[model samples]
Target: MNRRTLLTAAATGVAAASLPSMAAASPAMTVKDTMNRTALYRSSARTQLAALRWGSTTARGLLEQVLAHQAEVNPGVNALATLDVAGARAAANRADQYLARTGRTLGPLHGLPMTVKDALETAGLRTTCGSPDLADHVPGKDADVIALLRQAGAVIVGKSNVPPLCQDLQTSNPIFGTTSNPFSPAHTAGGSSGGPAAAVATGMSALEVGSDLAGSLRLPAAYCGVYALRTSRGSSPIVPTRGHIPRPPGWLTSSDMLTLGPIARDADDLDLLLDVLAAPAPADRRAWRIDLPEPVSRTLDGQRIGVWADDAYCRVDTSTRDVLEQVTREVRAAGAVLDESSRPVDFAASNILFQKLMYATSAATAPDAVFQGEVKAADAVTEDSPSALYLKSRTMRHRDWAKADEERQKLRAAWDAYFETHDLLITPAAPTAAVPDQSSVPAPERYITVDGVRRSFYDQTSWINLASPVGLPSLVMPAGKTRDGLPLAIQIIGPYLADRSVIAAAKALAKLLPTPPKAPGLMA
Candidate 1:
């Protein structure tokens, strides 16, 4: 399809919700049309951009709609950590003027309004990362990813909330308090990208930039019933070279598993943001240019797919298992050759290695006193101690860390071998939908109940661990809802550097799956 035809489809088909309402200022609009315009704010980012391109709405008007919706809902959701109203409005005005005068867009995302995860720094915008110490912290320059987003003509409206240091599985900090699940205020939004997920799900923003290392990005996307991509890392760098938290501002080194990605309400939006963000960081731009490959297959028919529905080591709840079963059946009915018995790597072993390497990398920022304390604790603890693994991993020797890194390489090789025959792998994004609010409880003491039995809090990330350690492209999209009416989702994993393949699968599967239900009162 041509550009105008694509835009027309986006306006009429993908965003049926947007067509019910017209621009608020249109003299032809009726009272109902003006009332329905509130839902226009919830339209997909692509639809909004299409409307802007077609002269149906101005950038400033779209920003106003988003800001108004956020004002109405954020008090209850607490999704936004900061707001740059004046700056965003000014940028939107410039976008309007540029398009009107030049008859061309700034870029693919021209005039798009969205939020960034608090973990990512934005110039002149306070990014506390939900920490008290950095409550007043503001950067003078944007992070590499933020700069890229701006170059694509995205307006930085504000920053979303996150857990302190982006460490916990639940988003809560002294600075922003706790972000509630949009579906039910009683439930916790999964973290450390919880705020971004909630914001996207509830229409506070059209898209967001979030980071994931150990399910931070996908877990929340699953919990809130949105889409997120944990882009692959290979010969090229897919994330910012610096300015992410946990390394402190200005530090260049970060975790090997940690990666930055896009979060949005649909797969097409994920593709749109990924195109703008897949390039190298500023310092390497002159020498490195990324041209990620196209999808392996555009349709499910004739595709070779693998299903890792549930594992004995970390089983999902009944609801999640049912969703996986339904998805696999749909894939088979669609003529995809499905393999249900293939195990890419040993799940138990891979998770152990992931934990060790994750802790070792996180140890870089540990204070001298804390490292010394962990060393002492490691000497005193027995293998039976509950904290033994953590202490040993956090205080691991350089040689021990090297061994773990080597094991990760073998795991990656195993995944590559599996993909040699299979086009994609499907699994649960989490063991269950959004778990009950656990923000009031401390991290170590927290636990999630599965099958009416208490499971380790960290198990929420067990399924997600498979993709992170191996540096594969992973996409999470809503599958269905639990009996309780909460959102549930599946994870699609692709070969290393084949990011587009997973997104393509997601786009195809989205047609077969039920549209994720919007949050109750807020979306209504």
Candidate 2:
């Protein structure tokens, strides 16, 4: 997912189910998601749409519920920045009118409400992008995904918050303060999509659209104990780039990494949204009526899975590791053959090269008037210092980026080889579990805390790069929680573009895991 505006992209809440259930209470992979009434915060596009049809709630009614909830709890949790009561009400009213006049539907998302990330424009609504400069800017056209959702009848609820230019993993900007994790308000909801995560985790809305470049979407999902899909890069309709973007066509193929998809409460719900978003742009495949491919696994009965809980490059918090271990054990006990073997993958080099290409992509270019930041940084560089490396990388020559590209191909090839023997792989989504806010930390120093403990600010990207570089689909699902009650998650990665198969595996594995604990923040 492209979490930052640099990629110019695409872009949930919660409540309880009041429906009666005769099904046995057990680990709800999708069932707990559909049945949990304590308000576990993240919303599923599938669940929301189903509720609209089955519960007689209009778009306006759902918006009213979130607005009312926000009024009572937003001050305590700090999730929303801008709420589009009027715009959302207007959209909801239109949906209600449609339902009244015509039994026919607008699309799959009729009457669903989604809180959009502010980085993407929402016509007629302010899109601040967490920058003071964009605090009042409003584009005439909606982002591609927004228009698609609208066609499907998703009411725009208003803009969520982000970090400035989405330069940090923690969400905090001069315009919007910070988004705290619902599990523990002092910790983060994870950025640059934190606000949406916080909002969804607090039961504010049912679904959210967020982007991820460097684990933004997945990290937030993990911390919030929700399900998030970071699809193979370019799976969703690509958004146009803005200022600082260079190169012909002004389109970015940044490491061919990063993605945009859905964040919900379970695997099936996550798939429901992913399918709707996967429709090729109207111009591209609507005319041809493209169909989605099935999941890679024949069935979960005897599937072969490769799992890596931790690695030498990054240390997973014990809780996160434990959750995955349990998931692996459960899957095995359920009859799937689990492989603890390491495949022929270049994780260390993949990450190192990814860093070079990623930062270069971020520092892509500047206009004549705004070249000051680059000039100052160049002048500030001392011989052979880290700044010099940055300067050299920033102005990356074709040969330099090509070198990284070659390495990327090698990594992709390595993945191809690995997949020949295994159908799927699982690992920790991030090294830590919603650590203290890191907004004030410098990029380089971000990896090394002021306390002198070394950690990779980019470490979260380690496992993410595997899926991204190869353009593979990865699903992040809650494995369980920590002794302290924090959420822990695992990533299920499938062959590039084999999304359906990954969904099947997650559903089967979900049946094996323990019942995830109910969150404590549902009271709000």
Candidate 3:
């Protein structure tokens, strides 16, 4: 059968029975009982890979468990935009045969079934960026990151949902609708990578690849109570953005600030994905092999950590602040030196520059008609209106963008100086836990209640915006849960191109913080 036909069969929940089953029926954790399935889903990727190698579980068996979990949870959460069961089964069969025949595994991610955000194109699968215009769009090839995953023996199960054109902070599009928080249905799974985060949170997928531009990857991982890494973004960038949307399919170039990384259930899993996905662009790899720096210290002992708990510009809510305070106190107790007085860069100034540059880059990909509309809209808006800043930035002159780019270089220098003294900087992932589902509200009109006071909906991204503009590696890990049972998270920012160091810091910090919280609805 052709690719489209296979996808159609998979969408209809057809099992690929014609393919070889790959494993003996007597193996542990068959798709027979909930208890065995629970054990399978709760295990980490490393543990699962060991099981795969030891013959305790087959690739096809694990894929069945993942599909069963997805079938149970995805309807309520709406995390996955498309699922290709037939294709996954076929791949799993191939993986099992190779292992059984050669007594050797494929690669680091051998037999791991995972999902990618729909913003990413997958060969032969529908990849709608939550836009009606591209509802039927299916790429003939995979995104660069997806290709890397496939090369590492990962089974691409499906594509996760994203906001339409990935423009909003909430994951909802006219096509896939809204993705609810895995912890609570009333709250949003933060977007444009919300689906990937939620899927990882609920064990629907073992790993997910999500892109970040203006906190798209980290914010959702924070909200969904998972782990995400915004890979190093400098001269030697990690993951390429060749197949991501917003540049539109078939376009070669993506935005400067946009990046792709992994979202998974644990920090170590994030590290595992970094190993598989981190590579230079195809053109650069012929001569360049990017090697990120190692962590400053393996443990928290004698480490200089910076704690920016809350800020006046974008103050976190009381619950979030409490969690931050607790985390800091724990870090200090663990023998790590904490510095609270040193500010890396001014929040207000950096945020302003970020907005100006981000808006300009976002506008670069807009259609001619849409660009003209934004120009007209900029002229009609009042100087002090909430939308004025965005419109002006979107319509800024090239010289103005050049000036902002220069300022960004200076900001990068300031971050480098700060990291010279500090091993890692920890901050609130957002102003609060997952905000209420605001899919129906317009982007500018949405509000988040911080300390019972209404704040701008965009404030959810203020803390997260710090790492993106300066080309730094930032990791978001679940800190704890809110009083009302929502997820609270903290961001770990390291020096530019220090991607491994950032994940290492996260690994150490995780030891001091509380055990990561599990979502209540499905995992409860």
Candidate 4:
């Protein structure tokens, strides 16, 4: 799509980004009876279940242990916005009973505990949507995805924290307070999924649900040394039964470009959660029900990867670059083939197209600043005729958004073509390590280094944007820590609806890389 057309088409933006589980005696368990540890501490959701099965432990016991640990540690991390201990336990008990009576498993998540971002409503819980305005608002029914997970036998442990209105990367709200990075207390835990990422990194939960419009999920994963997946737009069920978006008569209900997906310490668990979360909702919820195709790889031999780490618009930070280099080297060392040199193919152009559309997203989200910028920028191009639909959509109009909708389709087509040649694209998750806490992050504030060069913190959303607009899938996994002990990770962007391929690739890379360290005093 042409630059003007793309900008004209967008008047948009998108969502929280992630939450956990327990110790069982069976294969997925790794607990120690002697030390009261069951191979469960800091174990991946996938591995924990494996240890439980191996140890012949009960799922109910594992769920209890996981829940107990989260309650115990959350006092320090401040991750949960609302935890439903009684309800979660009741659900866990039912899952165990079902296993005994029917001898049939609900799904991969049977007895596993998970947390959804507060932006997703869970019936009877406070679905604050990360805003003080709705701090005490409770929902009467679960969100479509929440219902799917409940049916899959996963326990809804709690609701996770997001920045107020999910408008920023720092996860803080007047109602729930702030969530700090387990690595450095002074650094923000990338939001609005910061609470979930921090919880996952600290071994407080097994898997988390977070949304990302412009790096909401990816940034937290990068900042917290965890893995997050942003599925292709609409690929997962997002029934608004509990009303995440309380729209008036003519307003839009949640942005269509963003998606809700799972965050985990392992790729396998991501797939497991995706299965539960992405299924079709019941008949009444069909408008947003999407059919996600099966995973691309049954084996790793033919899996082609296109890797890009930097671009001219925003330079990847030192620690970020360092980790990406290591990821590239490690993937090459493994059986995977590298595309070529360090150049990110057409990243400058990709980012340019992304920025306009992004501003549209922010415009709807933050309203004043985002739309004001668009109006100001639209003024900059003095000679051309622009659509009133675009201007009105940015400012006043709500419906008849068809013109911008067509523009987004063109961009999606371009990205679809790009992904046809590559199974997955690899890049940095964020441009820098965690930013300092308590400092207001001006949208234009760059991640400046000791060398005195300014780089956009908004650029941190570049990699995720590649996947967001076209609704392509992206997976994030921690690579290693920086010299100063900050976290570093990479995003594996996959083709549309190719969510499984991204997770599988992340899993493969994670095995070859160093394991994420347990946060200090957070996970023991």
Q: By lDDT, who's the top model here?
A: 1
- TM-score, per-candidate, Cα-based: 0.93, 0.84, 0.93, 0.80
Candidate 2 achieves a global lDDT of 0.67
Weakest 10 consecutive residues of candidate 2 by summed lDDT: 2-11
lDDT at 266, model 2: 70
Q: How close is candidate 4 to the true structure, as a TM-score?
A: 0.80
lDDT of 4 by residue, 149-196 (tens): 777777776788788767777888777788888888888898888988
Q: Write the per-residue lDDT of candidate 2 for residues 1-524, one digit (tens) a residue.
A: 11222111111222223222213334443323332442322345565666667644555556555554555556666666676665676787788788778866678888776787776667777777788877777666666667877888888777777787665677888876888788886777788778777766666656777777777777788778777777765424332222110121223333345466777767787677776777554455546543557876646767778888778776776666777778877878877778897765767777767677776766644565445566567667876785676665666668979888788778877887888888889888887677776667766566623123567666655776667655677888877777778887788888767777888887887777876554454542
lDDT of 1 by residue, 1-524 (tens): 32123223322332222333453356666433453545566788999899888877778767766765676577788888877776887898899999999999998899898889999888998888888888888988888899998999998888899999998888998877899999989888899999999999988889998898889999999898899999997634586647888678778777877899999889999999999988887888799888889998889999999999999899899999999999999999999999999999999999999998888888898889988988999989999998888889999899998888889899999999999999999999999889998889866788998889899999999998799998999999999998888999999999998999999999999999887788753354
lDDT of 3 by residue, 280-307 (tens): 8888889988676777777877889999
Clashes per candidate, residues 3 or more apart or on different chains: 0, 17, 0, 47
Select the stronger candidate by TM-score from 2 and 4.
2
Reference-based lDDT, each prediction: 0.85, 0.67, 0.84, 0.67
User: Where does model 3 exceed 4 Å of error?
Assistant: 1-38, 376-382, 521-524
**Two-way TM-score contest, 2 vs 3, winner:** 3
Q: Which residue runs does candidate 1 get wrong by more than 4 Å? A: 1-35, 521-524
Candidate 3 accuracy as lDDT: 0.84
lDDT of 4 at 356: 47
